[model samples]
Target: MAVAPPTTSQNPLQLELQALKAQHPQYHVVIWATYGGSASLLPGARWIRRDTLSISTNRRNSWNFTYGTHLYDYYVIIEGKFEYHNKRMKAADYSSFVASTAGFDFGTKQSVMRPKPEFRADSWMKHLSDDLLRHGPLVLDKQLDDVLDDVKDFLEDNDREVVMVMLSFSSASAVYEAGKPWSEGYRIKYDEVPDHFNREFKKDMKKDKDLYTGKKWPRLGEVRGKVVICRGWDVDAEQDQWGLHCRLPKWEAAHGFTSNIKPSALAAHRWNELVGDFGKQDAPKSIVLAACLHHDPADEESWIPPLQTAPILQRKAEEHIRKSTKKTKHLWIYGDEMKKKTNMAIAKLNFLGSDDVDFTRPPPMTVKSAPVLLVATH
Candidate 1:
């Protein structure tokens, strides 16, 4: 799991998102924070390519439109880079409120200061209390409703490229908590237990054992409007560890990162993961493929490095596996040029090749490998 630090505006946008959830309780709003400045707070970032970009809400979420329930009022896309901070602190050990000592105060006839002299009682406990108390947990100057309104406008305005997806909390915890009905006070009430489980024991369990044949992955690759499958688990290239090569067996993952797994396992595994829409009735199996060039252990960038473009893509396109291509059960991304571009951290799925549509032809797994490339920003 690529656990990034909480972005700078996380708290503020979170508070605003909570308020928006309270207001709109009809659709499933999925907010996709791209690289930076989440759409819920910052405006004019992500956008959809269309004639006139405008907010469209479907009161009757249905299949006619093909868009999920109109479920999400829209897509909140934050298309910018991010600066992640690294902090390893446990809440259990830290004090919530620290009271600064007298050393911080400005008083007449104060004692002279020394390099490492500690005479005053006010040091760790009472240092910087004024700023800490004044600023609060996070900067909370903006109104929740106002922030949401800005998001709504940016999404509907249709001029910007960045857009936000607005939906009902009926889908996720954030929305549900934000939209909880409140009469007297803002603290709304909610029933966390899923609604589908009521009035039945284990009856609600799936009847088909093979309902989801493939694994649930952390990363997803969309190819020609379908889901693309990639690597498997079991990084160790050992005989005993080779069993994870099966697609369905190693599908349960947080990120689409299975490159390090043994080749033997990959041999047995057909698909790396499932995506684009799994359970939908009319969902298609369209998949795309890409390769992260630096996946090789010898590649210095594989561990500690910055972004740079070289012959990596060409190298990838030239040597894509073919035996894997013959069994095109799903989209196979093997071209050497399909190098790792994005490192969203769901395992090794960093390649975001150019969005080239190949509905008529299959990927390099069969014979000719298609080259798609994405630039690594950070």
Candidate 2:
């Protein structure tokens, strides 16, 4: 008798799902963020209404839910990008949080004025491994499996382009230590988990890519309605690393935008880059952005507000449209509450249904409804 391959308690599907959920619980935030922005104004693009974005109550608990309920023809998940801190934090406190989360005992170490290898803490990877072992894999494989299967179906389909921007939680710390050697050492320590998760997630995604081998599809090639795929993360070919690179944009520098909130700027940069890259190349008819929700949990003094993040996304989308041809963008939200909150936030931006411009598409009417009907009543 042939023996089946041995399987572990946590399969690849479960592992990937755990990593994604832990990093980006609100995974479809990108779609919600970009929907009302300028990208929706592109001609020939379909208009998405607020009511249509609600997710079934049953699916709300699912981490691997399909974005927009499979309404689009093509779906693509962009890799490399992960959620970063949208607010400021003290370096020492930030370091402590990461170390504790990873199970490192930073308290035992004495404060040193200068950094040396002797002062370096243990490899954070060990703590992370232990943490995973302690928590065990979350029971989310089934939902995630369904989501990935949906993407696989899109990849096989030759009709249109569908993309999903996936954001990774690259680290427990939102800000990395810079300049000071002590902080630099801590940054390196904190990055261990993010680096490992990125490698593993990409490995799983590549398996999906392999399924497309031997199939040939025609490129859309500047037909004005070609489908596009937009990824939010930066992929470094030389280093084989996938994540955001620490850099300052000229505009932000001129405006004195601080480092903690660079993720917003990066998000905008990736949006414009997609427009330029896709406009120049032939691809699918639809674009999917795979990005993290980037909403942080409640904290001591204050919480990361979705309202603040909403404008950043709006600005990013607006900037992209100003530089490239406009296209219809889609929005999807998981629940009624989120949909309402997101709509309100987007509305306040004055980018949608504003005095200067209107983003709401005219309601579709059938032939009979369009005809001038004369009242026959006496």
Give the runs in model 1 whose Cα sits over 4 Å from its true position.
1-34, 38-82, 89-150, 156-193, 196-250, 253-281, 284-378
Instruction: Kindly report which residue stretches of model 2 are placed more than 4 angstroms away from their true locations once superposed.
Output: 1-299, 302-307, 319-378
The candidate that achieves the highest TM-score relative to the unseen native structure: 2
TM-score of model 2 relative to the true fold?
0.29
lDDT of candidate 2 over 153-222, digit per residue (tens): 4335423333322332222222324443322323223344455754675566556532221112312222
In candidate 2, position 31 carries an lDDT of 21
| CA lDDT, every model vs. true structure | 0.23, 0.27
RMSD of each: 20.6, 16.7
